[model samples]
Target: MAGDRALLRQALSTGEETDGRVEFKERLSREVHLSEARFESLAAQLRHRVLSGDGEATYVVGVTDEGHVAGIKPDAFSESMDVLNLIADEAGAHLDAVETWGTKDGIVGVATVKDGGTLEIATDHLIVGTAGHVDHGKSTLVGSLVTGRPDDGEGGMRSYLDVKPHEIERGLSADLSYGVYGFDDAGPVRVDKPDRKSDRATVVESADRVVSFVDTVGHEPWLSTTIRGLLGQKLDYGLLTVAADDGPTETTREHLGVLLATDLPTIVAITKTDLVSAAETDAVQRDVERLLRQAGRSPLSIARHGTDAALDEIGDGVVPIVRTSAITMDGLSTLDTLFEQLPKTAAAGGEFRMYIDRTYRITGVGPVASGTIESGTVAAGDSLLVGPVQEGTFEEAEVRSIEMHYHRVDRAEAGRIVGIALKGIEETDLERGMALVPKSADPTPTRRFKAEVMVLNHPTRIHTGYEPVVHLETVSEAARFEPLDGQLLPGDSGETEIEFKFNPYLIEPGQQFVFREGQSKGVGTVTQCIE
Candidate 1:
């Protein structure tokens, strides 16, 4: 009975959270009236409560367009069976009984319950809030939320789990860190403690329903790190935090520009808001908004509170404004609510592949590929296909174990950064853009691919078939571009028939990629292998 409700809500919701209060108002009707009598009946029978937590209960309601109640909506039909199974299996016969009826002009379905049940459901709503800017207190905000104290340590802050060759060359040091956190309507979701002051990393717990945050370093050299933070994962939304008192600096503007260009559902956090009074905060907020508008966004929502109010606003779909002060512990709670407010993490369960961001061989460990698990899971002892080395060679490797944060785990899924130990593979066999996947399902490999390339940051416009360095699957190599059509100007998209002078095999078709000029880079995806 309990499991039934969890499945119902999980299936129907487009990755959002309820206030935990099961109040039903007819969507088609204008007046916000609660059907207390029906709700009580559903609530009394314990049919609606799927998974109940401490101070949290998620309810599922099926209704029609005409302000009536139906047992379950038509679209929710197939999944409701799972809910019924759960109801029968976990809650017993009495609790398993579900009531279906028609009301007014439409039909409504209700599941009500009051009880204790532990059901692990995958998240429909997941978001990543990147903490950028050097020593900009990115880790401090993480510490305050996780440890309930200000973060004062430094070094070994892992910002991204990537599989790009350059990213691998950037290397993982004490300074590279990945932090994930989960939050809900009330407050911070429980997170494991960071290993040490310097190794501050957080993992958004699996049980988390709505929001997950990824904190990154704000140092200058980590621009690629920042790009990895953004491009490494397909995010539903982004939270860009800038210190209010410091004003808009150059790096701040550059990062801000990139985020805006991505058109990601974005929210801006003006940190240190507590340092300024109401008036000062307002002034800074205006300045930030102006800068953002200059970047082509309408004024975004700004929050200046020590409470979770900002987070609530974020959860409620307010954009552009969030204020937090780790120093005063103000607005710390808002971070979660703000995170919850964004759109849900897209269902990314298709291909189980990742670009290798970093690779190294410990004297005894063999070859280790450290990167975020982009789409699928990698398990211990699973044969991994490592491929498309710049030299066009493919190699088979074995996954010894997977690590999330610093803790070893048997497997890792999409949305988490993980490290895998590869046996029978050498460091030279891998590059930053190389990909790793399960051995059974092979990847199509080709050195030359037909793709659509856009020239961004190039010294001049790129004509069709021009030569450029191709960055794909963690490796970057020189390739000849045979444009499918005309010249590609900056910011314009064009299809090209590209053929490498020498074919580098091991990459598949349909893989998205980036092209790097001496210092500038543009984005593209593999369409067809030229052969």
Candidate 2:
């Protein structure tokens, strides 16, 4: 993807002429003086350009039609983009992204436009979360897959994903990391330099469809962080990694249980196959299959029945297993094919809802909140409420701008991770687990709820007033539980009333939650919301 972008940039630098899919413009025309007929003509041309690119097109601003890079000033470039946006709106398209570069003459930039309805396709966008035990090669596999590079047999590829300096120094990931790759008409467009943020942005802009991986910690001490990554994000699929040498460990079972609890369709990858012989790999595979059966999952090896059968029945209690080795690049292509063809199961058709996972403040952009659009759609200028603050109240906020994968967009739909610039709010007022909902929702914060919980593990029976940390979406808080049926024991299913200890949260009925304290764990679904 980086190579493709460089080629386009070089062509523009050398004064490439305008074409159907690529247009060059020295400046934009003022719309105030244009007649209706002229405006209609311009709109028609813009529509043609978008259609020529199969729902996407590029416009090179500050360039001449006759192949001249006559760069314009920054102020002039901004105005030109304003006009271009108007043109796109008139043509029923939107400016999806923009990038600029400074030249000796002036400033030049590229604008990507796409038809409004094309982004709703499920296969075009997908999110997969990675989970497994420590040193199981989770990060290494993801790094190799996204960068198309093999490891140096000593964790060379994992460096691309380790975000914090401590993690790099410790040779393990201690926090959640993100990596992405995309698919074009030709196939997957992997990152040449996975460590470069710019290269990732380029891949997001150029690919026809994208797949985002949420890499979570695999160590036992950071299990809470791993749980947050799984249950908080609106994930479409799960990629569970297991080392061929270690087979299935206690941590592997724990992570797998969380993935299954969230009802996310999952695929298992047996890593480090090169270090073990075929018999050892086979033994590990059998152990994984036996573990899956113990958890009520049907295991289907992709090597035997192929990807078609696994893809067809993955979400229906069937888990696909693929053998891979980062050093040898074995089974990477199969993994790519599976991801490319996997159908999205998360639906985004309800009223607008987004759970805040993190917050940021940019120099000129003011306060920004980011999260996955849990349901429905949100656009710039829409009125929404953002809160459940420490005071347990909701505050009004307006969407100033929307961005996905560093690309500025007019709107975002469900199942997408986006950053939304906000108006009428301070960054300090927002917190994780707070929600952004439509003004019409008139949401109420909840302090207590009733849930049907199944105890997965506990040394003893749970009684009233037992406190455990409950994880729901992006929010994690300690809650006291009282069993509705006298008492609950391990492997028991019963009703319970739970109340948050401190702050209230925007919790909805039918939402799943995980409660854990030390070695004890339980899964539950909210049955009713008590205001």
Candidate 3:
């Protein structure tokens, strides 16, 4: 990642030759080179590179003799990797990881051959998404927690995450905004003006353990945005807020259903407890318990049983309830402790994938794609395919740089939200609902897929010709749903074929989706795909 790059490089040096730790091979011969001296010679060079790197080396396949990136055939590249694998093994090393992307007519990849053995990168940070009714103090509670400052009860602290002018005037968040703080070896590390990009970046870099809040809107009209937060982002847990004075609203229950439907571990936070008497707070807790039980989930009291038990039971169909007051900062530390100790349930593995949630152009950096890495790791200089344009195709692009929050970083792993500055694409081409994937992934966009769908709520029944907008990852589009059988009523699970009414998207089997139309809502899983 340092200095110049050749697909992958721990550090490339100045001049025609590299730092001796990086190697470029168009293709490695699979002939009897292993038993011959040719293998020993190549293995000896790899060993020297490892020694030079202190037991780490980088190998770039499909490079031309002209020093250009002319990708090789897939078979040749595989053989090259096989040969490199043998060399690494002979040199007392292993191919720890490989990152692949599309080239002009073929594909290129970087193999991180290492001798130190694989180390597990723990997801020290937990991303908690907030959901509730408007004016339940979702934003204000997050603002106070991130700044370590108690709200003045006049809703002054809401500015920490709420950005839009209209949202400020209306005292409600209208879209998704993120605020993060961290815990270090000492304790919690709070920052000022966390709404700013730079401050949030500082938190991610400085803290040993970090917690991010995806503050979502609670208004009925902005329900799509809330669903986007719950469905699009790689969220670890859900925080549903219910004011003690007004326990749970219709919107609160709807949000809870969607959160639990996504199978995200949820925690109910009784907010504004100071506004009501102790008895009233107790009544709100009971109401929350009833709602959880109605939803077929158990409730655990953090105050009664403690944070350790809440963490243990929250994943096992248990919804932990915590009481909080932005006015007094009550119960903030309990949530903080729980967050600090919570292991990131999300992980980074498999093929590198990211969905573009936001896009922007830097003053001189051109277009950048921002989103959380959904599956695998990505590095600067990695080639990726982005899009499923109206034509249902993808365009090749190269990652020029990577940045987390606002601080420029060399690489990013899964579950880490980042903005990737790109080359070979215009800013106008990037949009939400699009995705970034490795070229070798060979992902295809599909218009029709058979899914196992269940109607959560509906007026009558779902028959052929029923249309609902399906929210798959970041791709949201209306699709025609035809029951494979006769018809489906509420709570009826059946096979259905869905054809995108508009643009085709990069979707596959086993992916989950949430669809909604008017008063009808449901959750489904793609069982099979058809182009």
Each model's TM-score?
0.60, 0.79, 0.77
For model 1, residues 1-531, the per-residue Cα lDDT tens digits are 123344444424422234232433222111211144533343333333334233323334454333234543332432342333333234432121223334344334443333433222234436464645654455556556555554333312222232235643543222344444555555555444554312322233343453445555466665655655565555566767777667667667656655655555666767776656877777777877888767667654543343344344432333457677776767766555555454555455866787777777533234678765667666666887887654555678877545554444446667655668676777777767677877887677665567765565666677755676664544546677666656777777888876655555555566666665554556676777755
Tens digits of per-residue lDDT, candidate 2, 1-531, equal 112357347547655334457777787766541457776887788888888779977888777887577888755765576677767878888777666766787767777788762223223678899999999999999999998888999998898899889998887898778888988889998998777765776777778888989899999999988988898889999999999989999999999999998788999999999999999999999999999999899999999999899878898789999999999999899999998888887887999999988898753244789888899999977999988876887899988678776666668899888889887888999888899999888788999999999999999999999999999998899999999987899999999999999989999889999999999999999999997
Ranking by lDDT: 2, 3, 1
In model 2, the worst 10-residue window by lDDT is: 116-125
Top candidate on TM-score is 2
* Per-residue lDDT of model 3, residues 348-430, tens digit only: 68899998888987532448898788998897679999988658789999886677665555577888777898878888988
Query: What count of clashes does model 2 give?
Result: 0
What residue runs in model 2 are displaced by over 4 Å at the alpha carbon? 1-123
- The C-alpha lDDT values of all candidates are 0.54, 0.85, 0.81
The TM-score between candidate 1 and the true structure equals 0.60
The global Cα lDDT (0 to 1) of model 1 is 0.54
- Quantify how close model 2 is to the true structure by its C-alpha RMSD in Å: 6.6
State in Å the error of residue 36, model 2.
17
